[model samples]
Target: MLYNIIFIALFIFVIYVFYKKYSKKAKTIPPHWHSILLKEVAFYKNLEPSEQKRFQDRMMQFLAEVYIDSVDFEIEELDTILIASSAVIPVFSFKEWHYPTVTGIIVYPDHFNEDFEFSNKSESRRIAGVVGTGRLEGKMILSRKALRHGFSNKTDKGNTAIHEFVHLIDKMDDNIDGIPEILMQNMNAIPWLKLVHDKMEAINNDKSDIRAYGGTKQAEFFAVASEYFFERPKLMKRKHPELFKMMAECFRVKF
Candidate 1:
């Protein structure tokens, strides 16, 4: 009788603790921009009404669950981040994963320089014009100017947020390669590599609108592809039909 009573008490205590944790988590709202205008900005005007509604709900839920840190920016500057986040929500709707590992966002005034230690060699390198950086476990650093430039330039085929977020996605498998697990699961690695190789060859032969940065590595290819996927979907579809199809399948969205 005594043991039964103690066991019941322990179970109740565990349940209480879990309930308290969940309730506390539920009470916290996501970080928001200072002005209402930032919240109102919409980047997906081209989406259908039904799709837009769905995306809005998902974005709200995502924001509520994920922590966002906005640094040293006026209320208006935050509008771009809000709009970009809202726009990308639709791309994630097909997957069950709602949140990324990234919890913090560090924003700079403009493009910044970063030093990197080479993995293969005992050498240090410096890179300039760094717009953004995304870590595997929920940390992102970005430049405000780069963010604006990414969204503002429609024809440039460069998107800093998308690029960083793609790195975050790539890190899901604890690998920084361009191939995310979702794409790898659905497509063969060999074919993906072959396609990328062919594309890089074409890009090198003549500068395609895909951008020169994409030729740096396979990981960069994924990031660059993500930019085009969202920015120039029609062009990507027209130019690389199969690759575009694969991206659509991985992201669980229709072009």
Candidate 2:
């Protein structure tokens, strides 16, 4: 009887702790953030008012759950809103969703390289964003310049933040080799790889509109193609029908 009583008490204690931790994430978003989203993010701006509310809820939930830190620059409201907005855009189709694999976000003043150096004097600082690995697992690092640039160039169809987050989604399946089994369960790896290789050939030959970097490999192809898919769905659908169809199905969206 004492053992049963102890076990029940421990279970209740765990539940209480969990509730206390997550309940704080449910607070309503601030009023001004809506204006920021309306002004800056094209993805958010295009959403229906009702869907925009849902997007705001999810974006605020992301801000609450995931901590954002800056390495050098002061983190601004635009920085936080853009980062959280990037995180929300990819997973918005899911009603109740958050990045379990991402622990936090670190924003650098500029691009960093493989050595993770971001000094202004260094020429090696070329990478825009990266999903952490090894000791830095479950973390994301972004270049403030690249992060803002992603949104500023609305027609480019390249968002470093979204690119990295797609990598995180790919990472969630424990294999970041390209296929996100969690998101693309309906699509098998073989066909996906085949499609990736075909498109990569086109990119390498300058015969495709998909980004050149996607031609690097299967994983990059997934992320790059996803950037295009989300950024300009109409163009992608009109230009690359098959790939867009796959993307729409993978994201579980009609468009």
Q: How far is 102's C-alpha from truth in model 2 (Å)? A: 1.1
Which residue pairs in candidate 2 have backbone atoms (N, alpha carbon, C) closer than 3 angstroms, thus clashing? none
lDDT of each: 0.61, 0.88
What tens digits encode model 2's per-residue C-alpha lDDT throughout 80-181? 999999998888898777677886999999998888889977778889999998898878999999999988887887989999999988888888888898
lDDT of 1 by residue, 89-109 (tens): 435556444434455555555
Error of 1 at 73 (Å): 3.6
Model 2 lDDT, full chain set:
0.88
- How well does candidate 2 score on lDDT at residue 71? 92
Each prediction's number of clashing residue pairs = 3, 0
What TM-score does each of the candidates earn?
A: 0.71, 0.90
